[model samples]
Target: MYYKEYGNTGMKVSAIGLGTMRYDEQDVKAGRFEKCAEIPLYALENGINYWDTAPFYCDDKSEIITGIALSQVKRSDVYVTSKTNFSTLGDHPSRDDFRRRLETSLDRLKTDYIDFYHMWCMLNLESWERHMEVLYSFFEEAEREGLIRNIVFSSHMQGDDIETVVETGKFKGMLIGYNALNHRFRQSGIEKAYENGMGVVVMNPLGGGMIPNHPEAFTYLTEGTDLTVPQAALRFVASHKEITVTLAGCTTKEHIDDAVKAVENLEEYSAQEIVKQFEGKGASLNNLCTGCGYCKGCPKEIEIPKYMDAYNQYIFTGKKKSILDRLDNHWDISKEKVLECIACRKCEEQCTQHLPIVERLKEIGEIS
Candidate 1:
């Protein structure tokens, strides 16, 4: 396994890290711990030392399984990273909460100190400012107490908010969503984060499974490359000089093998070649919607990007029922709100990427 320096934290982590989201279900289905444990141990035996998990994953079962697997190895030989949601941190944050969570995680994982502690899925500017003090304080205490070695945060932020966080110079690492279909971060956000000594870890590297077999999505990467869609997608993100690791969520051993093989012989594609490959695929309104939600404060109260995301997911993967089911579960807006787009063309004018918003909304309303 090829290893990369994890920012300036003085730790080298595998380019292909083991993600634990699949372990909980797999463990339950296989009716044995060895079934779930095998994948992670196989990864470690193959020289993968970076393991990432979260308390929210499988209701905290992921960390438990990870801990069980790593206990077989000497603690100093591996790295474990986990995250806490800010909502759980609460107001009047105490070391007790931090310590309790750490102890619980350690006990579940059967390990001592975590190599990295991340604030997971931070979305907006307000959320950042709201939790910054408590976050910093908790990290400071944890580091001083020898509970965690590094501090990081993962963001789905776009535009200025991403820039704001990267410029803070507080984090040792930043995990963001990046793939062949999602290249919005390659602008100032990723470059600035690297410049500030922050390790860039990519999530949704296959565009959340949208790139693997979806011909429409595959077109973006197969324009001129000999690589398969998955390989191209993996290489596209891994090729970035700033990216330290691209996190792949693989369920089966075969999936893990494919990812490791891809990384083993990964080649850097030049910036011009990268741009040309995506350009030849032809841009759609779907491509234009970076899901940034810059135009979301619409007076009509339209959930602009959410609907677009659902539509893109449906069109890209042919998972229409699943997409609609998700939309029904999460979207509280009325049917009128869904159909009430007046085609004022105001949203298109305000779009940062100059997307034809009115046309896209019309199509979405028709679909619904």
Candidate 2:
């Protein structure tokens, strides 16, 4: 229920924004959006005003379901977000193509104007420049026409790359992946966005379901607190002053309630103090992979993300058997393939967290 000014937007967004990507598949496929739609309604009832969705989320029905919930509420009471994927637009994309996508999004959402319309999935500066080249003007035209209130982007690029994007001053806000496990990688980007008076919303605040799945691995965050590991994980991001909203992908009513309670009695914690806690008890926490899959395109064709996910299990249990089991049972990859790494450091170079990927691969080779 705690609200903070989203940068200098003059809008006080809820600390916990409802991320509408995780609706129940059965309900969604059965054309049962009314049931799944209740989740966001519950979130709104609990003081969440920010609802984020996209064209392709939840089998391309997330925006429709979110629109169902928005129908019952006054438009001004909620800040709605949706996105258009630049990659999906074919080569030689035109302004009309972008506008067509926007019109479709508006039709699906049953709303005339989106509070925040994003240039979705800016992977690097090159892609960002391409988006600017192809569709930035269309975004501006839409904004001037009152079809979108704010122009923003979502990225998973490194801190320096993100700073470069912010320096363009083209956006009012940004959504980036940040969590207890990988904050160091994206810290500079978050700070730079905030410094430039841009709202910074965190997308994968739960490490893409890794933290909640293995709560025991992050006990340090909950020490001396009444919060569960998930709440503590959420608070870890919400506690940062630079962050505007912590987007949680909620499915059930309980998920919405838990996200609400996590930020209801919000407490701001110093970045240094939170970092110190990690350094004291879990210095290696930052090395744990969130399975972002940025480390693909290995020249040797090694499944790097799968091995790193296995590494997470190893970190959690401190058991070599866990690593072997992870590779065999979950990833269905042989342990011997860990030796395929040529130490070329391609994956390392692309890693957002700057993890010692080669070193970890070597360790996995030795242990497994």
Candidate 3:
């Protein structure tokens, strides 16, 4: 229940926030509402006041469950965060689409105003700029009309986007994909956000469950620490000076309990020690692909990074079928696209993170 100042907003948020992404599982054959409702309620009773959810998660069912669970708690005692998928905010989203989506979200959540509203899944500079205009306008109107209290965005973009957004000085918070496996923010983006007075909220603090004790991807820290895989991962993110809260999307009460225990006994570790812990054991971000598909426009029409991303997701999250299913559904990519990497070294040159793209792609094709 430790609290931290949420940026300069003067609001003290819990160091551990509740993430609702796991509430609605498409794979579950049974109903989830009864069990899902308890996770938030238990979290709230234990002092976790920050709740993060999104419309894209489980097709908005996560938000609906979140709202229902939070209804039992006083609104003033909790902060609810939800996001809109900006990919749908097309060149010109129709008034109906915009209004319908917003209204639907509010209704589903059963809340008059959301504590924080974000533009979700922002990946590139072009998408960021295009959606910023729409998002700022929407938030401005919502604030004036009392529909939302704060503005924010969640990004999987690089340092440049982080700098641009923070410099705007409009958003109250920024959710970044950060964890032991993905430390891009710590390199510079996180510092930039802090410099511009923006609150940093960390998503995927477990590298999408990769920080846990997976036989293939387990880091040295996982083997040496007294903490469990999840504990080490959560603690690593929570220990960061820049992060206000580390969000964990818990599916079961057991998941919630483990996370709560980790945060309750959370220790402050030096950055050097944390870095040393993950020095080896296949946890480095050296050859990782984020599945962003930014390198897909190559003349060769290769599905370069996505395959690697899927492989990582499978190994880390233990959601092999789910990742494969997503790739199978979303992209009309061919087997050749997945298997025909020539190692021309073209993709390696274009990667922003300077990852060994060709090698990773080859590994992915072989592994998945």
Candidate 4:
């Protein structure tokens, strides 16, 4: 595996880090520790030095298994990363609560200190404002005392709040969603984060498994290369010069191998050029929605991706009535109800592509 400079941390992280959030449920529940253990070992054997996990994955069993696998290998050979939900202990959680969670992970992982400790699922600006002081104190003390090597946070949020956090000059990194489709919405912010000398880690590089399962939907990925759509997706994110790691969720050994090979085979420029081709002409929105769901939290709960799918069908199949019937019956979303949208523009803000949501809602039923 290849390594990249992880911002100003003076660490060289593997481009394809193992994201351990999607452990196999059957294996985890059945207590097949060996089965679940295979992935991390495979990753380590393949020179993946970064292993990322959280306390909640696999019903809080992931840390235990990951800790075991890491112990079997050279401890100093791999970087251990995990996340915590300090806010879950209520808005004004005591600093002890933060330490308790960290200690729990440490106990489970059998490690003295984590290489990266993240404030898990940081999705809101207001919540950060409420929790910042205690968190900052906890992180500062943790680092000074050598409890964690770096401080980072993960989020599905885009725009100014993320910018605020990155600008604090405190955090070492952030894990956020960035793929071909989602890049348009957050590229500027990501670039700015690079400019500020903060490490950027990517989550959901596959658009939550859309690109792999629906190759026909993204033929642009196949235009000039032998890459399957999913390989193209991995390449797209890892190719970004500022990104420190591309964290792909691998539930199977094959998944891990495929992710590694994708980055290995595709040059960074090839991925960048392929994504750019789709920007204006190559891949139209009507072709595929990618189903990443970054354009979520709509006030009306309109299920925006379903609408996009219907819209895509209409464009490809010329089946307007089919689109209408499914939206009206199967999804229970009708043109009339869609009109209820407050035009709040929240979805558009999260959307990297800048899809004209309000205008498209008006034309949901109109034929091309």
Candidate 5:
């Protein structure tokens, strides 16, 4: 129920935004998007006013499911955010192509206009420049045409580079990956965005389910508090004055309730205090893969995210059986696929966390 100003844009967004990327896999695979659609509807009814989706999220059904939910609500009641990624838009997208993409998103979201449209998945200055050269003016045109209210971007780059992006003064907002494990790494960019009067939304607030899945590994974040580890993680991002929203990739109604509950009573904590609290914990988590799936496009056709997620199980429990169980039951990736990684390091190059992915694959391949 808590809301904050989205910068000086005169829009107040929910402190806990609903992210549509983590809808139930079975529902998506079985073409039961109506079941997936209900979660966003439930979230909107329950006080979440911000809904973020994209074309490819949830097996390319997120925007459709989001559209289904938005249809039942008054359009002005919620702020809708979607993205246009370079991977999808291609290297030389024309203005007409950009307009087409926007119109397609409008159709999928069941809205005539988007509240916020992002320069999705920006990785470095090179990519930022490329987008600016090829598509920034088109984004400006869309804003002027009332197709989108704000032009924003999402990034996984470090703070300094992101600060440079903010300095361009081209965006109205930004969504970045920030959590207890990596906030320090991206804090400067967040502060820069705030200083530039740009709205800052924190994605991957639960470290892409890492913090909740391994609560014991992050007890320091909740020590001396009545909050659960997930609650603590949510609070850590929401408590920041610079942050406009902390997005939780909620799949169930309970997840929505839990996310809403986590921010009900936010305490003002100093950034340094949070940093100091998590000072020594970096070694355990800085290298942890968040399952963001940016590491796709493997030349060998390996499902890198699945193996990295399985590796996470091994990291937590130190049991080969744990990794095997995750690959078999949850991911459906076989050990043979794990062994297929040819050390091309292509995935590692694209990885947001720059994890030792090939080495991890080697270790997984040697298992049993």
Candidate 6:
């Protein structure tokens, strides 16, 4: 397996890190710990040393099963990453509760310390501000007590929130949403973090399993080569020199094999070239928003990005039910938001892609 310098952390992480989110659902459902454990164990044998898991992944069995797997391997052979949701911060998280949570993770992983601990699901600056004072104290204490090697955060917010959080320079790393469809909006903050020498681990690099299904849509990434769509997508991310880890949340060995082969055969390509190709052909050139977030602060509090993502989903896969389900269930974006648009052209005016925001809203209303 290939390795890359994990930014200022000074760790040589496997370029193909293992994300243990989908660890054999069938095996897990059957209560076959051994079968599920084989997944990470197989990944280790394949030279993927950066094993990432969380308490929430795999129906809250990820950390437990991953811990069981880690116990069999030499502790030093892997760098462990885990996260805490802490979305319940309004319940008033005491430091002891926080430490207990960390200790519980360490206990489950069968390791004394986590290599990277992420403040999971960090959205905007306001959300962080709500927990800043408490989190800062807990982070320092966790480090001083050797519970974590470095403090990091994971965010899905591609708006001004990401840049605001990264510029503080308080984190050792960040895990943000990065993929072919989403990169344009997050690039600025990603570069800023890289500039500060912080490790950047990208989640949703496969567009949350959207790319592989629409392989034909991304033939442009192959660029006159015979690379498959997923291969092109993974290689495209590695082509960005600033990116430290392009996360593959694989559930199957086949999935790992695909990503491994993609990275193994990675050929440098121009991101601009790929994007330009998408703008014209080789990808769906529907009324797509680049996720620029210029249409943010909607007066009606509409989640325009969620709307655009759903549109892109339909355009990419030609699956109307999946698109509607994603917008409704996965993204939690209400179709009812269309009623709140107020016929405002404000979002259109601020759009860099100049997509038809009002028209899309009308179409979204007709999604049923």
C-alpha RMSD of each candidate structure in angstroms: 6.0, 2.9, 5.9, 4.3, 3.0, 6.0
Top candidate by lDDT = 5
TM-score of 2: 0.89
Write down the TM-score of every candidate.
0.78, 0.89, 0.78, 0.80, 0.88, 0.79
The clash count for each model shown is 1, 0, 0, 2, 0, 0
Q: Residue 53: error of model 5 in Å?
A: 0.8
Q: Model 5 — TM-score against the truth?
A: 0.88
Where does the lowest 10-residue lDDT sum fall in candidate 4? 281-290
lDDT of 6 at 353: 48
Candidate 2 regions exceeding 4 Å error are 276-278, 293-304, 316-321, 336-368
Model 3 regions lying over 4 Å from their true place: 24-32, 94-96, 184-186, 213-219, 222-225, 267-283, 290-306, 309-368
Q: What C-alpha lDDT, on a 0 to 100 scale, does residue 284 get in candidate 6?
A: 37
Query: Across residues 237-314, which tens digit of lDDT does each residue of candidate 6 receive?
Result: 876766777877777778788778777745444445545545655443424554546578788888887887787777
User: lDDT of each model, Cα atoms only?
Assistant: 0.71, 0.87, 0.70, 0.76, 0.87, 0.76
The best-first sequence of candidates by lDDT reads: 5, 2, 4, 6, 1, 3
Q: Report the C-alpha displacement of residue 127, candidate 2, in angstroms.
A: 2.0
Give the range where candidate 2 is weakest over 10 consecutive residues by summed lDDT: 276-285
Instruction: Rate residue 1 of model 4 by lDDT.
Output: 84
lDDT agreement of model 6 with the native: 0.76
Angstrom error at residue 115, model 3: 0.7
Clashing pairs in 5: none
| TM-score leader | 2
* Angstrom error at residue 323, model 3: 16
Per-residue lDDT over 1-368 for candidate 2, one digit per residue giving the tens place of the 0 to 100 score? 89989877899999999999899999999999999889988899999999999987899999999999898899899999998866556766788888888998898888999999999888777778888888899899999999999999998788899999999999999999898877877888888988899998998888977988987778888887888999888988998888899999999999888888788678776565667657756445667888877788999899998899898887778787898898888989987887888899988766756679999888888972
The better-scoring model by TM-score among 4 and 6 is 4
